[model samples]
Target: MLKFNHLFNTLVLLFPIFTYASFNVGFKQINLDKVGSRPLNIAVWYPAKNSGETIAISDNTVFYGSRVIPNGKPLLSNNKYPLIVFSHGYGGSWRNLSWLAYELTGQGYIVVAPNHPGTTILNRDIKQSVQLWQRPRDLSRTIDAISIDEDLASYIDMNKISAIGYSLGGWTVIALAGGRFNTALFKQDCMTHSNLKACELVSDLGLDNPELNNSMKDPRIKAFITLDSGLARGFTPQSLKNMDIPSLVIGAGIDVGDMAVELESGYLQQFLTKSLSTYIVIPDAMHFSFMQVCKVGAVDLLNKESEGEGIICQDGGTRERTEIHRELSYLITGFLSKIFLNTAD
Candidate 1:
C-alpha cells in the first residue's frame, strides 16, 4: 500500500490541477450487469481540495512495467477536471489501463472505466469469457449508471464527457457513438482463420450480437476516439459520413517484412458530414499501442511467433511507445478542450 502512496504523492506533485478537484476511485467490485449505472471503482483525478483521506495508489505494469517513473505516473490526477470515460482493450483489468486513466484525470477529466467481464484479468475463466460479447451493452450501461445513479449524478457534467478507447475498447466507443458494432462482421473477418487465437482474440466478442448492438442508445457522449480500432462491423458512409461530431481515428500500417506497423489515424476527413473527423497514423506501431506494460512488454510475445511465419518485428523501444502515448494524451486533451470544454457543441 505504501508503494501506491509513494506513487500517488509523486504523481500529485507533477499534476496539480488548476481547474477542478481530482479524486480517484480504484479497484472497486464491478457489476458486469451495470455500465452507466455503476460507480466503477474509478479514480476521479482533478484539482480537488485534498480530502483528508490518504488512499493508496497502485503500481501496475503501466509506467515502464513495475518500474515507476521519477515523481511520475502519467495516469496521475490533476485539478478542475472535465469528465472522460476511458475504455480498455480486451482481456485486461481496470488497473491495466490506469496509466491512461491517471493521465486524463491528472489533466482535468473525470475518467471512468469498467472491467469488461470476460475481457478482464480472469480472462481464462470460461464463464467470464461470456462478458466479451457484452461490451457495447456494458459501455452504454456504464454511461447510464453514472448518469442516473444518485451517487455520481451530481459530480459529472454529462455534456462535458468524451470517450477514449483502444482496440476492442475502440470498437465499443464507436458503437456508443452510434456506429454499428456487430458479431456477424467479426465472424466475417474471422472466416479465414482456423485457430483458437482467431476465435478468442477476434471473433467470439459479443460486439456482433445484434440484440446487443441494436439496443445501444447514448446521447451524453459528446465525441469519440478509436485507437487501432479497425473497420466497424457496419460502416457505411450514411452511418458515419455525416457524423458532425468530432471524431478521431488512429490506426497502424504494417510492414510485412519488418513486423513494424505504420501508425495511422483514419477518419474520412473529406466527408463533410463527418466534418470534425481527423486521422493520424503512428509509424512503426503495432496492434498493442494502447495497453498497459504487460501488453507492451510482451509485445515480443507475439512477435516471437511472427518469426516462425517469416516475419521479423523491429521492437521499437518503450521510449518510442511512451512518446506515442504522450501524443495520444495531447491529442485527446486538445480535442476535448476544443469541442467539449473551450467550445460549446
Candidate 2:
C-alpha cells in the first residue's frame, strides 16, 4: 500500500492538474439591411465573472454540443482581450466552431462566430449562397456590430483583432486579407476539373460574374487562419502576393472526395509571397474533421437521414476527432499567443 501510494504520488506530480478559466456564451441577431445583406445570427464567447446554468450548445442527435454558461456576467478586467472572429464552412452555423470558441475564451480572448445567411444550416437559400461575395461581408459586418456592442466592445482590443475560418470560411478571411477573386480563372479551372465538388457546383455558384473580382478586404483583421479552405483557385496569384498580413494556413492531409490540400490550402500558401504565413497539414484529419464532434451513433443516424451524410463523422487515420481537435487547439492557441500575447513556445 505504501509503495502504491508513492507511485501514485509520483505520477500525479509528473502530470499536474490544469485549470481553465470560466466563460460564458451569448447569442444575438444583428441586422445587415444597411449593407444590403440578410440578418446574421451570431454567438459570442468570452470570460465570465460568475457561473450561470450550464447548458449544451448546438446539441442534436448527430453532433455533441459544447457545455457552457449562458448569459453569465462578463469577467471584470482592466486589460483588454484580443478579439477573434470565426467563420464556419459552407452550410455550417456558428455552432460548428463552438468548441474552439470555448477554448479561446478560457485562454482570455473574445471569440465571435456568425451564421452567414443562405449558407448556414438553419437557413439555406440557393440565391444567397451563390453570392459568395456577401459571405465575407457578413464577417465584416459582424465586426462592425460587435465594435459598438455595449457588453463586449469595452472588453475587446480593436487593434488586436484576428480572423479564423474553415472550408469556404477560409476563403472568406483570405478575401478580407486582400485576396482578390478572378471569376474567369475559377470558371476555366472548373471546366477542366468538373469532378471536383466545388467545380460541380460552378453552374449554380455563378463564378463567371465580374462582380466577384471586386476587392472585399477588411483591414481590421490583423492576423488570419484558414482550415481546408475551398475556392482558392479563384484568387489570382497577384492578389495573394499582395496579402500583407500574418497568416496560418492549415490543411487536412487526407483528401475526402473533391477537396485536395495541394489544390486548396497548399495553393494559398504557395502564392502568399508577401505575408508571413505558416503552413501545417494535419495528417489524420479530413475536410469534415474540423466541424463539431459527433455523438456515438452519429454516423448511422446521419446516413439514415440522408445517404452519405455519415461521411461528416469520418476521419483519415485512426485518431479520433477529439484527438485531432487537441492538436488543432495546441497549434492555433500557440499561434495566437505568439502573435497577440508574445508568448510563443
Candidate 3:
C-alpha cells in the first residue's frame, strides 16, 4: 500500500540526501566503426541506493568549481533497474546537466546521457556532425550494443525503459517515441522556411530525415517523455502512426528560444493511439530551467538565436522556478513508476 506521503513528500524532505549512488558514474565509450564512421561518447549515471555503494563518482571538476561538489548519487537498482536515456539540448554535452542525471538516479532508475556528435561544443561546427537526425539512430545503436554486448546488461533492465530529452534532445525523443522525420519529406519547404538557405539546410528537428531508418524501432524502450522538445520540423498524421507507447510531453511557460512550438504537444496527442499520453506545461519557467547548465546568478540560459533570449534576473524570485522543477520531477517519477511497476490503477 503506497501512501500519499510517498508521493507528496518528495517535494518536502528536510534531511534529503540525494546520495552518491546517483553521483557522477561514467561508462566507457561505444565504437560504431562497423555501423558508422567514428566511435561515439555516452555519459552514464547508474541507479543505486544512495546509502552505501562502493562505486566511482566522476570528478572531472573543470568548470567553475561547479563539478567540485561531490557525492549525491542515483537511486538503487537493488533488483533490476529500468533504463532512462537523457538527451541534451543543441550545442551542449553530457557534462552540462549532471544534476538532472543524478536526481533521476535518486528516483530509482538508471540514466543514460549521450553527447551527440557535432552538436557538442567540443566540435562547434554543427554542419559536420553525423549526430543530428542521427541522434535517435545513435541512441538505438548504442542501446543495441549495450544490451547485446556491453557490461551494461548486468546493471540495466532493458525491458523496462523510457527516454527524456531536453530541447534538441526533446526533438530526438519525439522522433524516438515514433514521430517520423524525413529530410526529403521537407526538402522543398525547408529551402524557404530556413534563413540559412545556402548554408546547408540543417534541421534541429528530426522529421523525415534519411538518418531515421528502422533505428527507432527499439523494443527495449517501453515508454517515452520529452521536455521542451516540441517538433521543430514538420510531421504528418501518418508520420506519427507508430506511436503506441505511453508518453509524457513537458514544456516550459516561456520559450527560451524559437526551439519549441506551442501546439506540437497537442498535435502529438491527436496522432497517438494510446490515451495515456499526457502533456504538461510548467508555468513561469524557461527552457534552460530543466537543465543544470543555467543558473540564477552566475549562469544565464537564453540562447543568442532567440528573441526570448534575455538574462533571467534572479533577485530571490527563483524559488518558484525551483518548485516548478521539483514538481515536474515528481510527475515524471510517478509516470515512470506506473509503467515500470505495471500499476495501471
Best by TM-score: 2
Superposed on all Cα atoms, model 2 deviates from the true structure by an RMSD in Å of 7.2
How much lDDT does each candidate structure score? 0.51, 0.80, 0.58
Off by over 4 Å in 2: 1-37, 342-345
Model 2 C-alpha lDDT per residue in residues 42-124, reported as the tens digit of each score: 78888876666777787888888877767667787667878899999888888888888878888778888888877888777
Models sorted by lDDT, best on top: 2, 3, 1
What lDDT score goes with residue 94 in model 1?
59
Compose the digit string of candidate 3's lDDT tens values, residues 1-345.
111233344442432323223433433444555355545677666643334434333333222112311233333345666788877777777765566566676655667676777777685554445446577776776676667644557766777878887767776777776776655645654565453221132544333446654435555568888776644444556756567788877766565444333544545556656476776665556666665433333323343445434443221235554575576666777677767777221
Which of the two candidates, 1 or 2, achieves a greater lDDT against the reference? 2
Per candidate, the number of residue pairs that clash is 54, 0, 22
lDDT of 1 at 164: 74
Of candidates 2 and 1, the better by TM-score:
2
Error of 3 at 284 (Å): 1.0
Q: How do all models score by TM-score?
A: 0.67, 0.89, 0.71
Model 3 per-residue lDDT at 193 = 47
lDDT of 1 by residue, 54-131 (tens): 343445332343212222222333222356776776665656556676666554565667766666655545444444
